[model samples]
Target: MCGIVGAVAQRNIVSILVEGLRRLEYRGYDSCGVAVLADGMPKRARSVARVADLDAQVHETKLDGATGIAHTRWATHGAPVTDNAHPIFSRDTVALVHNGIIENYESLREMLRGKGYEFVSQTDTEVVTHLIHSLYAGDLFAAVREAVKQLHGAFAIAVLHKDQPHTVVGARQGSPLVVGLGDGENFLASDALALAGSTERFIFLEEGDVCELSLDGVKITGRDGQAAEREVRNVVAYGGAVELGPYRHFMQKEIFEQPRAISDTIPATEAFDPSIFGEGAGAVFGEIDSLLILACGTSYYSGLTAKYWLESIAKIPTQVEIASEYRYRDSVPNPKSLVVVISQSGETADTLAALKHAQDLGHRHTLSVCNVGTSAMVRLTGLSFLTRAGREIGVASTKAFTTQLVALFVLAATLGKQRGHLDAAQEANYIKQLRHLPAALNSVLALEPQIIAWSEEFSRKENALFLGRGMHYPIALEGALKLKEISYIHAEAYPAGELKHGPLALVTEAMPVVTVAPNDALLEKLKSNIQEVRARGGELYVFADADTKIVNDEGLHVIRMPEHYGLLSPILHVVPLQLLAYHTACARGTDVDKPRNLAKSVTVE
Candidate 1:
């Protein structure tokens, strides 16, 4: 995934483009470039550095123009070098910036080469710039429209032509693209975060929609080449959400925001109701006999945790699958199964594709648990539960994962009530537990000082292990994921019962084992698993409930949780692990927010 911003305005657009790239830097930050049409020619600046360095270059050279397009790239087809950066030019007449992959670029490159066009960089986007230049006949809009018809994969592109000054053309196929409205200017960006203070109104383009932006107005065309009207809604940008207030990293800030986020996600309700999902959710819930959860990355772990809740509390059979793998394998599709998709951005490409695949297989009862309300997953699903987590900017998710768990717990309780598995009194008890989550989260966050000391030890190690049982196994997996994501450490998680079978062979005095020990039904079995590791001389670091009676001794380190939350311990236990990862990354002097080889959003398959 890459970030793109384009502007056609009455004033110089250099500052606006630079600021937009800074806000959109979370999408990609491998290399950045900007192209502006000035003095009847295209002036360009490129950098194989961060956005701040590129901004400095732009200002030092006094790059100015009324029309321009900028890009921050996460390289897919080529190395993260200056030549492979976006704002690629063609015949010195046109420049373009692109987001998704062009699957048919090889054939297009050969065709363009036969037409006497020489390629300079190793990128799929260069072929698009050449193709657009080849089709230009004094009309940039018509050229973009005709050129997109030859593409074979996902793409969101913004183009600027020297001949068409004060104009910018953009198109989208499978990636996200939005048009921003202003008084005497218009903007195009892959995300609305780029246009935060510039415009509050945005038009989210549909699949295969091409848009033209000018100082006068905007024009959009549908896939059939006919004029189309998409609603322009007022979107509140993440002005204060992106700021790093008093925390050293966004991950730290997000870890502390969990209490507020959980409180916002679970409504101030006295009783359980399916209507919290959306209108007609009760009908959908009544029609389903099973659930199939599709998700990727951290969202997948949250789904794994929800399966335990759905089966135990709701008395429903549930299956969880990795979204990227679900579409490639064939399975018996049950029409009565409710397909649930979970995502932080709600624009995850693999999850969206899996949702469509499920719909094609006659699974009509669909739902989404997501953070963004204006995302494609929300629009495509019949019902949705919006996680009020605000904007999550950390590459490794913290608040979004916990909020998803809260939303899914609400779903499980609602289904339990619908199936008669829970009576009125039981339902009220579940509500009481959900209401106390905010205070419980605050309690977990207070253990950061203890975890910071543990992080110092972890920073000196090259590998680690995580252990849990029952529903907490998924939380262990998430903890391992967070550690590996930011700290550059190799970590693995195993169900405590499964450790003796194979993983116990790796246990040694040099290895650190982190365990999640809640006082649940599996605690006794987990204690034996802990003895298995300790007997092998592996140092143990345990996060246990105060009532578990687990104490620290020689070779055993324990940090007591404030209380043990039955069936809801995963949400509280995950907060300390996030803190461990963040502080460990800080101790190692790594980039805690933007990890290498990873972007915040996965917009391409």
Candidate 2:
């Protein structure tokens, strides 16, 4: 996904737009561009690399204007080149910055070419500009609406017209768009993070909603030209403390901040009272026959962990599916089913699509556990639980996954209590354990140096195997994903008991086998799996709890984590794996923060 930002102001706005682009650079950094309305026409400055390159060019040849749009692209439809950058202009009149994919752009481009609409860039976004120019009828908003009507797929567009220099129009279908309120100025961005420095009040535009913004105010309207009303929400700004502090990168800072994030997420009895689930939640759990957990990427691992919790702890039949594949499948959910979608950026494209599909299939009860408050998934779901992970910057997801598990654990506990599967003592005990997770995580983080040393061995390895069982199986999957995502290592996760099925054949002295052997009900079986690897001469790196009597033998690398409550061990076990992945990537000299061809958020399908 790309990032889009636009500002309509009474004063010169180029600096503000560039600053907004800088704030949004975490969303994407492949290329950056800006278009400003100047002298009754649109002027552009763009580059194929970092924003600093474009900033240098802009400084040399200033394009002063009061209204403009900017974009930092992640390059979906075309190659990452200067010509393919955003701020795609239409015959030097209107400029557009788009943040999503245009699925029908190839056909639309052919038709537009036949109609004598010349294009310069090989991007789906360029087609939008040409389509708008071909359909202009004195109203840029109307032309944009009509242009989008003829197209298909996800997009959040910010269009500026040279003829109407004082105004900017924005619309969204499947991607995220938020309008920020400012004094004698207004802002448009793909997410709240881009506007956090300028505004706290925002309007979250829904699907098919169009908004025209000017220095005076903003007007909301629908695709059919009828006026629409939108709710203004207050966003808490991340102040100066938002910097990386003493850490080298945001990823490292985030990894170390997990303890604090966990502390903030787990609520006390007075704050998050158990009685809150006494209403419709109880009724829903009692009446619901089955459960479906839908998610993508790291969130999918969270859903898998939730499936184990729901099935074993709450005694509910649960199914976990990758959101992209779930929507296209032929299976039908029962009418009494509860669908739960977990996401950090709740705007994840596939997850949102799956949630919509479930709604369309007549699933009346749905819930979203997400981090963002006004994301599409949260707005569409019947209920939502916001995870207080606070702006995860790493593409591999460290804090968000743990927070999602915390939220899912809470949900599981609620359902278990409702169905009489958990008594008051058990519920209270789990809640109390949840409260101590932050401190336990703090203890686990102290082992980062040890894990980093272990990572040095992994740099020479070509492949690795991650093993766990039950709830820890999801942690194994997440660990493998993190390692593969940052280090380019070929890694796979298998349930400890399923090792003999097929994966055991891959074990060798050259391969490193990572086993999650935290003390649990299945620890003995996990030990057997480790023995199987050891017998095969596979180098073993075991993350074990301190009290667990796991012997340190030859060819075994052991890192002892502080003994945490069994239910909270997953949260602690993930820290060392994160460190291991980080150090492995560092040793291999890969881009740890911004991985190759991967954006932080998947805002496009």
Off by over 4 Å in 1: none
On TM-score, the leading prediction is 1
- lDDT, candidate 1, 1-605, per-residue tens: 58999999999998889889888876647999999999999888999999889999998999999999999999899999998998999989999999989999999999999999999999999999999999999999999999999998889999989999988999998889999999989999988889998999999999889999999989999999999999999998875436788998888999999999999999678877888988999999999999999999999999999999999999999999999999889978999999999999988889998999999999999999999998989999999999989878789999999999999999999999999998999888888999899999998999989999999999999999999999999999999999999999999999999998999999997889999999998899999999998899999999999988889988899999999999899999999999998999999999999999999889988
lDDT against true structure, model 2: 0.85
Question: TM-score for all predictions?
Answer: 0.98, 0.96
Q: Model 1 TM-score?
A: 0.98
Candidate 2 lDDT, 478-554, residue by residue in tens:
99999999999999999989989999999999989998988888878888888888898988999988777886789
